[model samples]
Target: MRSKIEQIRMSKKNTADSGIDIIESPEALASQISRAEIFFIKYKKALIGVAIAIVAIVLAFAAYRFYIDSQESTAQSALSNVVYAMENDSLSQALNGSGGNEGLLAIADNYPGTDASNLAHLYAGIALIKQGKFDDAIDHLKSFSSSDLLVQGRAYALTGDAYMEKNQPEEAISYYKKAADYKSNEFFTPVYLMKLGIAQEKAKQPKDAIASYGKIIEEYPLSAEVTNAKKYKGLLEGEVGE
Candidate 1:
């Protein structure tokens, strides 16, 4: 009995020495609440300032988003009129704006970060190409960017065309390769590959030209360009054999 009593006393003493209270007293809980209240009182102004700063930041971001949306809407509206002019073959009006509508160049310049601005660069580049302004066409085409696979590929091909017009077959070959390789698909890749082969041929690279045409014949056999590719590949192979 004494031993068992001693064991109970040892357990209680060990628990106390460990400083771990399983049941917190009312006074301890009240003391904790008081400390928390004091802390809040001491930093009340700072905490309020932080909250106000966060709210201001949120409001500022919202305002900026709204402003951008409005700008995009205006730009899209303006760009549509210019596109209509282009479709109508009114190149001068499309570029220079005959009436109140801003031309493609103005839209591109006025709205730098908007999607409409980016598309304006593309339309302007194509217009410049039509005007035989090869250098300007290349510059505007290079400035344009898009996530759409078809548009981006077309831009690359247009850049190649501009370079080819400038009598820079090597530069044209590089851009044609980019167009052919980027997001290769059945519809567009064959067209770009044909352009690549032509550029390679002009650059005195018959072997590379043959390979490009072979790719179209083998990989994109159903494409309209496949027949042209086969003809060009045969021609290049004959020239290479000599």
Candidate 2:
């Protein structure tokens, strides 16, 4: 039975003769393809329009990217100059545009979409604060946003300082708390905590102020502010003997 089945399968395979064959005549295939081309030619204008549209979109995107790059470069250059002036304590020059050169304010105004522009806003706010323009400083500082915890903390602290200078103790305390809570690391954290405690004291919240100071003494005992924090905490506690 197995032999008969094998012989029958071989006879079927011989009859079918399964093998791929290539077209021997190229001209015949070309003519067939040419007939298909004539059908495609009917929609040639539509296809060309789509291709042109795609090319135009690609070119437009490229041009937009180039414009953004140029703007970023210009903004960065302006920011560097402003930073130099700021570092040298030339607050006026850093805020206001120098002769033929844009300042931080100008970069923030002209290149609103760039990172440099955002940083310029921060610089401008700091410069304005230094110049005793608290309202203007708050305006610029609030407009600036940053994901970096350190920079964000600084911005919040500057805003708090401006509020305190303006005699708005509540707003100052709010910002001080934000700065104190943000990214509770060793460096800025203790300083902001001291500021927060002082602000709380100013706000007439002695208990809260004591708590803030105690937090500094407990968590950041080695910080520079710890000594002051301990003093303030003791004073607030009003413990006479021990």
Q: How many clashing residue pairs appear in each of the predictions shown?
A: 0, 0
Expressed as tens digits, the lDDT of each residue in 1-242 for candidate 2 is: 56988999987876555321114456656777888899789989998999999999999999988888899998898787777789999988887878788988888889977889899889989889989999999999999998896999999999999998998888999998989888888999889889888888888888888889999998998899998999988988884323
Give the clashing pairs for model 2.
none
TM-score of predicted structure 2: 0.72
- Cα error, residue 121 of model 1, in Å, equals 0.9
The regions of model 2 sitting more than 4 angstroms off are 1-65, 239-242
Tens digits of per-residue lDDT, candidate 1, 1-242, equal: 56988999999998895444323566666777899999999999999999999999999999988887888999999998888899998888998786788998899899887889999999999999999999988988999998896999999999999999999999999899899988999999999999999988988889988989999989988999988888888877887793
Clashing pairs in 1: none
RMSD of 2: 6.7
Minimum summed lDDT over a 10-residue window in model 2 is located at: 16-25
Error of 1 at 143 (Å): 2.3
Give the C-alpha miss distance for residue 156 in model 1, angstroms: 1.1
| Top-lDDT candidate index | 1
What does the lDDT read for residue 18 in candidate 1?
A: 49
